[model samples]
Target: MKILITGGAGFIGSHFAVKMLKEQHEIAIIDNLHPYYSVDRKKQHLEVIKEAGDFQFYQTNLLDRDETINIIKEISPEAIVHLAALPGVAYSILRPLEYIDYDVKATVNVLEGAGMAGVKQVIFASSSSVYGMMKNVPFREEMAAGKPISPYAASKYAAESFCHVYGHLYGMNVKILRFFTVYGPWGRPDMAIANFIKKLKNNEEITIFGQGGSRDYTYVGDIVNGMGLALKNLKQSAIINIGSGRPISMDQLLDELRVYYPDMKIRTEKNRAGDVDRTWADISLARELLDYEPEVDFSKGIAETVAWAEQHEDFL
Candidate 1:
């Protein structure tokens, strides 16, 4: 399959690129390399992707509808894996307009462009944040995601809506996969895993929010595997959760860090607005549809992340 990935230079995007390439798929990526973090990190991710396999790349933005549509037409790919967006809950609170605009409007451009180009499948990179503050333990696909606590979540929900509309009106096969907390190598400094590791490595105080909370931290490799399955097996249009399905608390995560840094410093703070106490994924739908079974356990994944961070100490 020939595929176009919108944010191919980022963490999960790069991992997915390698996975798809190994599966004998040709890839073309579009990314502006927005400075949410150091562009160097994205460059490093590109280096890894290039080392893994052959692929084309475009330094462009989907917000520029003409450019995005033209590139889509030029590529004429069978699938468009839309993963690019301004992500971060706290960050979104500070810059809601910028984040929401990129998340919602840019997604509109991608969906429109894909529709115009007659793309067979559109795989959306949705988020677990859309299930904000749910009382349930494991969030299911049928659960209502209408009450998002953050602009970022709202924006993603809107993007998912656009995807559904495209599927309904244009007869495109849309696969909406709501990703949980994705972390691993090539991750950005904004993410908890990377930031905490960097802080611990530097002997800086790591801040904890509200006795801390649990999150379903899905490994990037696992997410890539599920995403690849979604790409290959989009029957019509569906929304599914691609996650680790194992929720671990922040204190528990810190305990895992203690395996490496035995005496890591930490401070507790009030929970930030729009933050959820926990996130657990009911991945039964993904398992049923995509045959997706997460391979990497949290302990192993955290250790691997620490190893990668140590390997690239200068970057952190």
Candidate 2:
């Protein structure tokens, strides 16, 4: 299959691209290399992916509707994995409009562009953040996600709704995957695990917002595999949760850092706005639909992530 992956230069997208290439699928990537993080880091990702497989890469922003459409038409991919977005819940609270433009508006462009190119299937990347601060233990796809606490979450939910609309109107088979807190090698520096590791290495005071709120920190490998499975068996328009079915707290994540840091320090602060109290996923739908099974254990994942941090000391 010829696949088009948006944000193919970022952490998860890059990994997914490698996975697809390994599966012998032809892929073309679109990425703006947003400076939300170091563009150099994204360039490094592109180099690594290029080493792993051959792919065509277009360095274009998704918000450029005409360009996005043209790129899709040029590639003429049978399927698309829409993974591009400004993705940070806390950051979204600080920059709501920017997030809306990048996350929501840009997603509309991708879906519309795909529709124009007559793409048969779309795998839209949603987030567990759409579940918001639900009191429920395990978030289900059927639950009401009407009250998103953060602009980031709201934007993802809006994108998800647009996916459904496009699917219903255009007969595109859309699979919406609500990703949990994904962490692993080549992880984003802004993420808690990576950020905290950086602070730990620098001997900087690590501030724990709301005591490092817990979440279902799914490993990237499992998420990528689940996405591949979802793409393979997508029969209709569906919203499914992709997670480990296990959630852990922020403090626990801190404690696990002892494997590397052994002597890091942390302080607790008030929770920031738009940050959820906790999140867990009910991935039964994914299990039934995609035969998705999360293989990496949380502690093992932490160890692996810490090892990556050791090698990429600059990221820390």
Candidate 3:
């Protein structure tokens, strides 16, 4: 199948692109190569995908309607995986309008373009942060996500709503997957796991927010696999959680890191606003709908990520 993946040079999207390419699917990637992190990292991801010899890439932004529409018309892809967005809770707090412009408006453009191009399916990248501070142990898809504490979460929720509208009004098959705290190779450096690992490797103090708050740290490989399954099993518009069905505290994660690197240090700090105290996903719906199950356990995934960081010590 020929597919278009937006933000395919970023962390999770890049991993998904590689996985899909290995499955012999033709891929066209669209990424602006934003300066959120090192552009060099994005270039490296592109190089890895180029080795596959069947992937095409476009350096563009979804906000430019003409460019995005033209690319879609030319590629005539059967499906789209929309992953491009300004994605950071703290960053959203600092720059709310940027978040709204990129996450919300860009999504609207994508949906409209896809509809005009007669695309069959779309898989959206949502976030567990949309659940806010739920009292439940594992968040369910049917639960209310109306109380988004941050601009980032609000934009994602708005994007999901746009997808739903497109699905209902135009009969588009849409799947909205809410990802938990995903980590692993090619992970975003701004995320907790990657930042902590980088700090530890450099013998710097890793900051702990809210005295070791817990999170459902899903691995990137597991997320990409589940996304592929969701794309394959799309029947109607749906919202699902993609996560390891368990939560791990920051203290526990730090201790595990110590086992790998005994000299690791931690510094406690207050939790930022709009940050959830904890997140655990109820993945039963995903299992039933997409046959999705997280394969890489937290400890194993962290170890693998640490090994990768060690090998690329200069980047740390």
TM-score of each: 0.98, 0.97, 0.98
Whole-model lDDT, model 3: 0.88
Find the 10 residues in a row with the least total lDDT in model 1.
228-237
| C-alpha lDDT score of every prediction, in listed order | 0.90, 0.89, 0.88
Instruction: Give one digit per residue, the lDDT tens place, for model 1 in 1-316.
Output: 9999989998889899988888889999999999998899898888989988989999998899999999999999999999999988998999999976799999989998999999999999999999988998799987855888999998899888988888887899999999999998877788889999999998999998897889999998899989988877658689999999989988789889999988788888898998888899999999999999999999999988999999999777
Stretches of candidate 2 exceeding 4 Å from the true structure: none
Worst 10 residues of 3 by lDDT: 307-316
How well does candidate 1 score on lDDT at residue 1?
90
What's the residue-level lDDT of 153 in candidate 2? 94
Model 3: lDDT of residue 262 = 92
